[model samples]
Target: MSVDGGHRRITNRLFYWMAGGCGFATGVVGAAFHLAVDRLLQWPHWLADRLGTGPLTIAAGAGVAALAITLAYLLTRYIAPETAGSGVPEVEGAMEGVREVRWRRVLPVKFVGGVLSLSAGLVGGREGPTIHIGASIGAALAEWLRLDKLDFHALLAAGAAAGLASAFNAPLAAVLFVIEETRRQFRYTFRSYVAVIVASAASAFGMELVGGTAPQFRIDTDALPLVMLPLFMVLGAALGVLGLAFNKTLLMALDWRAKAFARVPILYAVIVGAAIGALAFVMPMSVSGGERLIAEMPVADLPLKMLALIAVVRFVGTMASYPVGVPAGIFSPMLTLATTVGLIFGLLVEMALERSSFPVPPLTGAAFAVAAMGGLFSSTIRAPLVGVVLAVELTGAFELILPLMVTCVTAHVVAQVLGGRPIYEVLFERSERLAGRMPSVRSAVTSSPVGIDDPPRSETR
Candidate 1:
C-alpha cells in the first residue's frame, strides 16, 4: 500500500500487537461488566423472596424488569440502533464497507444497553454484544492512531477474538471462530492471525484474572464407547433439522419484531419483558442470560414434562428477546436450546436402550448435552472445528471429543444439504436490506482474500 511518503507500507505488526493489548483491556472490561450484570440479576429474586411470591411481589418484579428492558430499548432506538442483536453481522458488514461503524456511539451504547437488557432476564448472551464492544474499541483505536481502514480491519478482528475468549475462557476456539465463521469478511494476514492469537490469549487471561478459573459448565462426563458412534450421527441429524428450524423461526421473529417495533416501538420490549417476567415467577429456571441455566439443568432434577416446557419456553424466549433489535446475542441461547434437545433425546434413547441388549454409556444424557453444544453450533455457524473446541473448552467435557466431532460434522453437512447458510450471513443480508441496500451474500462468501473495498455485485435498491 502506498503512503503519503511515496513509500510502500506493509501491515504494521506493531499496531497489531498494540491492538492485542487493547483487546486485553476490552476483555477485562467486558468480563467485569458482565459480572456486574450477573450480580444485578439477583436483585429481583431477593425482592420477590423478601416480599413473598404474592401477587404484589410478582407485579413489582415484572414491573421492574419491564421498565429496565424498556429503557434499554429506548437507548437502542434513539442513541445507536446498530447496538441491536448479535452485532457480529454489523461488524462483518462494516469490514466489507457495506455498513459504517461509529465506534463513538456503538461502544457505550452496546455496553450499557447490553447490561440493561441482560439484567432484565432476557434470553440473550454476553459474547455477541461484548464482541461488538471490542470491535468498536478496535476501530476507535485505529482512528486514534491515524491508521487506515486496512489496519482497522485487523484490529477489529483481534478485538473480536478477545471478546469471545474472555467471555468463554476459550482462547483457541475464539481465534478459530473468527478464522472460520468470519473468514468471509476478515482479511487474514500473518500479522492479523498473530494479533488474533495474542488477543485471544490475553483476553482469556484477563477474564480468569477477574473471574474464577471455573469452566462455564460443571460436568464430569465419562468417555463414550465407540460402539455408540452411529448414535451421535443420528443425534447430529436431529440437531441439523432443529437448527434449520431455529434459524427460520429466528428470521420470522425478526420480521415480526420489525413490524411491531415500527408500530409501537418500545412496546415490543415492554410486552416481551413483562410476559417473560411473569413466566419467570413460575419457572424461574427458564429465564436469565442462559448459560448458567444450561449447567444447572442436568442437576435440577426437573421432570421430563417441566424440562420440556422450560426448553420450549426458553427457545421461544430466545426467538422473542433477541430479534427485537435488543442489545444481545443468540450464542448462549443456542447452547441452552441445544443442551435441552440433546438431554431429552438422550433420555428417550436411554429408555429405549434399557430394554435392548445394546451397550450404552451410563451417563448418556449428560454426554449428549455436552456434545450437542458442538452439534447445534456447527449447524448454525457452519464452523465445526470452532464449535467442537468451544463446546469442549467451555464445558470441560473433553472425554467425548470423538463423539463431538461426529455430531458436529454430521450436523454441518446435513444443514448444508438442506440449503442453510451460516446464521450470521443471513443476518448480514437482512440488516443490509433493512438499511436500504442489496448485496450478494454468495459472491462475498466465495470471494478470495476478503477485503472491505470493492463489494461484490448485488441487486440494487
Candidate 2:
C-alpha cells in the first residue's frame, strides 16, 4: 500500500482508541469531582445546623465561605483565565480552530478552581468545568500519543460528552448535547457518532458503579392538568424573555465592572464577596448556587409574592456573582429562576380555581418548574434535544417526557423568533475577538510564499 493509505489506516485506528479512552477517563474524573464537591458543600450546612442558627446568623461560617469563594475566583483569573466562566465557549472556540488548547495549564487549574468555586457557594454547576477539563485531558492524551489534529478533535469532543455524562449521570443527554450544540463545529459522521456514544455509555456506566443510577430529581409522575398546559406555554415564553434578560444583565454587569475597576481586579471580587456576605444575612437563598434551593423548593410552602421576590433576587444575584470573572456556570441560576416563576404561576392557578375539586398539587408546580428548567436552557442555547434529555435525567422525570418536550420545543421556537442567539456562541465570539488581538505563529507560516520549484503540486502540468 502507498504511504498515504498506510497513514490513513493508522489515523483511523488512533482516532477510535483515543476517543474511547478519553471518554472513559473523563467519566472517572467528572464523577470524582462531583462527589468531592457534594461532600464539601455539606460542611457549611452542617455547621449552621450545629450552631442552631441559619446560614446568616453563623457569621464565621458565612465569612469563611465567602472568602474561600472569592479567593478561588482570584486564582482562576490570575492563573488560568481560560478556565473562567462556563468554559463551554472555550471548547467551541477550540473546535472552530480559532483558539488553541493549552491542556497543561487548563486541566489542573479548571479542576482545582472548579472544586473550590463550587464548594464556596458560587452560583455555578460542575458540568461546565468538567466538560472543559475532560476535553483538555483528551487533547493532552492525543498529543502524547502523537495523533493528528483531526483525531484529537474527535477525542476532545468525545471527552466533553463523557464529562457531562458522568457529572449528571446522563449519558444519552451528554451525547445529544455535543451533537446538537456543537453541530456547527463538529464534523458529524458515523465514526464520530459512534465515538460519542461509546464515551457517553462508558461514563454512565462508571457513574452508576460509583454513584448509583438514580436521576438527579425525584419528581412525581402524575400527569399535568390540561388547564396547566396553557400556563406552561406562557411560562415558556416568559422564560425565553428571562433568558435574554439574563444574558443582557450579565454582559452589562461585566461592562460596568470593567469600566469602574480598570486597574484593581481584586477589588471587583472583594466587592462581590462583601455584597454576597450582606445578602446572606438578609436572604440566604439569593447568594449560593441554586442546588439546595432546587431540592428544597418543592416542599417549601412559599406564597406567590415571596416566590416572585426570590426569583428577582436570584436573577440579580446571579448577575452580580458572575461578572467578576469567576469560574462558574449559569445552569443552577437558570433552574432557580424557572422554578421560582413556575411556583408563582401554580399559586395563581390554585387561587383562581379554589372552588374546583381537582386541585393542583404543589408537586405539579415543582414538575413544571423542572420542565421549564430544561425549556429555558433549550431556548437560550438553541439545543432542544439536549435540554429535554438533561431535564429528564436531572430530575428523573421521564414520565413527564411529553410535557417536557412540548415546553422545550415551544421555548426554542419562541427564542428563535425573538432574534436571540445561542448564549455560548455569543461568548465564543467575544473570546475570539479578544484572542485575535494577540499574535499567532500561524500568521508567519501563511504569510510566507511558496517558491516556483517547491515541489510537484497536484495541479495539471
- The number of the candidate with the highest TM-score is 1
Candidate 1 structure lDDT? 0.80
What TM-scores do the predictions have?
A: 0.93, 0.86
RMSD to true structure for each model, in Å: 3.8, 8.0
Clashes, model 1: 0
lDDT of 2 at 200: 81
Per-residue accuracy of model 1 over 323-349 as CA lDDT, tens digit each: 656788888889988888888888888
TM-score between candidate 2 and the true structure: 0.86
Candidate 2: segments with Cα more than 4 A from true spot: 1-14, 45-59, 210-215, 225-228, 277-282, 355-362, 436-461
**Residue 389 miss distance in model 1 (angstroms):** 0.6
lDDT of 2 by residue, 1-461 (tens): 11332232234555666677787777777777877777776655676666656545556555766686677777787788898888778887787677778888888788877877776666666777888887888778767766555566677788788877876777898888887777766766676777878888887776666663321555554577666677667767877777676766777787788789889977877767666654554567887677767767767878777898999888887777777676777777877777787677667767777768766554677777777778888777778788888888777777677777878877877776676668887777666666675422222111111211122244336
Lowest summed lDDT window (length 10), candidate 2: 444-453
